[model samples]
Target: ESAEEVIGELRPLLKGILREDKKSIPDMNEDEKIMHGCLESKPKHIDSITRAIQMTPGKALSVLLSLELKGLVRQSDGKHFSLH
Candidate 1:
């Protein structure tokens, strides 16, 4: 499956893991919390995902590229990504 698909599949898993491990989700904004929850469960660090979560759409794309290069995530067939 593509990265986006992977992320979509993994998102809930990540959230579940975080909720289980941390006892509570990070007190971030909705977008930030979603992104943090996603990354916190990954095997590797994902700065791009964090940046994307924090910045505008244009910057988020840049962050996505960076995250891809870092091998923390993979790009989907479209505008999506999955953790590696």
Candidate 2:
């Protein structure tokens, strides 16, 4: 199979791992800590969130998108995000 096919096969397993990792954490995880950090202050754009969360832009967006998918955060105007 091609690389794309391999990735497609791994997608569901990766998602399951992420979900399980989210549940199994003892304390706030990097993602949750970032979420709470945003919640403590005003709503922020992705760039600001990256700075506030102290993570790379790609990593920050990934975490924020994950949160948005989980319904923990909402984005309005497709720019800013805040806790739901």
Instruction: Give all TM-scores, in the order shown.
Output: 0.38, 0.54
- Compared with the true structure, the alpha-carbon lDDT of candidate 1 equals 0.56
Q: How do the residues 1-84 of candidate 1 rate in per-residue lDDT, one tens digit apiece?
A: 999999999999999888788743223444433543465333433346545456566655565566556555566554555655
Error of 2 at 62 (Å): 0.7
**Among all candidates shown, the one with the greatest TM-score:** 2
Per-residue CA lDDT of model 2 for 1-84, tens digit only, reads: 999999999999999999977844335567766565675334678777777767887877777677776767677675677876
Off by over 4 Å in 2: 1-28, 40-42
**Which residue runs of candidate 1 sit more than 4 Å off their true CA positions?**
1-54
Predicted structure 1, TM vs. truth: 0.38
lDDT of 1 at 34: 54
Worst 10 residues of 1 by lDDT: 24-33
